[model samples]
Target: MPVASLNDIKAKVGADLGASPWIEVTQAHIDTFADVTGDRQFIHVDPDMAKQTPFGGTIAHGFLTLSLLSQMGAGVMMVPDTTKMVVNYGFDRVRFIAPVRSGKRVRGHFTLAAFEEKRPGQWQALHNVTVEIEGEDKPALTADWIGLIYV
Candidate 1:
């Protein structure tokens, strides 16, 4: 969806939401991320060692799950049009609610939390994102993220 001005986007305070798209977390993906982040902990890198943990097998890193918010949220962004360059501004709150075990599918449910003007041609938006595990009671991650847009 196209971006919108702060004022225009504000009208969507009670916007209807779209369904989340599911994504599978694979061992290969986790290994790649571990290599990228230089965080090759056994819980996330060694399947055999991870088996003894409550999680049963190597799990994807919390940050890796958090990073998928954008893709899952893409189908849920409410802005209709009015800006360019929507960049990752920051996060308000972030929590790793549950372990994302490898081979499990996770999805994100995005809800617009707030939108305000930061400048004449710039705006900031807050999204409350919940990433749920395919069959788990607890969500894998929950975070309030910010995005900055320029007209």
Candidate 2:
């Protein structure tokens, strides 16, 4: 992660923050997510059943991919040097464009879309995020993620 002054961080608006390291989406990951979320959908937890589907095999849940943004963003985000805390303000929009098959790798590409001071010691940042699946022509997901930072 890059550490910069608030002004310097804000200066990154419209800049590409770069891509995060690739993370493999294994069947175990899918199963754990399914168990935790109680979303026992056959396509996510049952490989044999999923094999007959269009995806060919079990696929990671869309929310599983979306939830990865936290781990992914930690690798590429810019943080203010004086920041005291940060909070997820939620996404403005999210679209799951392609299925992420189990055992495939995915990474995040982030761009600082907007940054501004919302209060004397608080700021809001909007990041345009694309989660790309390795070797795939289309990205797995895209979202506009918001964060609130306090310094």
Candidate 3:
């Protein structure tokens, strides 16, 4: 990711910020997420049982794919040179469009939807993101993610 001036970044509203490297969604990743979130649904942790479902095998939890935005964004997001800190400000919208089966690769595609100074030293940014599943026509999810940057 490149470090740019606030104005420079703001100029990129509506521009594609590129994509993160492909990351395989493993059964282990699903299990860990399920354990941590206490959402151990059979479809996510029980491969044999999951095989009976439409997905054919265990699928990653929706939140697991959503949470991966952090890792996915790191390689694609831009940082302001004067930024002091940045924090998640939640999402405007998020939709899980498809189930990511275990072993499938996924990556995020980001576009700068909005960027503006909300206060003297605070900036709010909105990124329109799509998490694409390798070899699949449909994406796993889409979200309008917001972030607060304090400089």
lDDT of 1 at 139: 93
TM-score of every prediction relative to native: 0.91, 0.98, 0.98
Residue-level lDDT of model 2, residues 95-118, one tens digit each, is: 999999999999999999999989
lDDT of 2: 0.95
Off by over 4 Å in 3: none
Clashing pairs in 2: none
User: What lDDT score is found at residue 92 in candidate 1?
Assistant: 88
> lDDT per model, in order?
0.84, 0.95, 0.95
Residue 48, model 1: lDDT of 96
The sequence of per-residue lDDT tens digits that candidate 1 reaches over residues 1-151 is: 5455556678876553554778999999999999999999999999999999988999999999998887887777866475567788889899998999999999887777787778888777788888889989999988988988776
Candidate 1 TM-score versus the reference? 0.91
**Cα miss at 40, model 3 (Å)?**
0.9
The digit string of per-residue lDDT tens for model 3 on 1-151 reads 5789988998999999999999999999999999999999999999999999999999999999999999999888887999899899999999999999999999999999999989899999999999999999999999999999998
RMSD to native, candidate 3: 0.7
Please rank every candidate by TM-score, starting with the best: 2, 3, 1
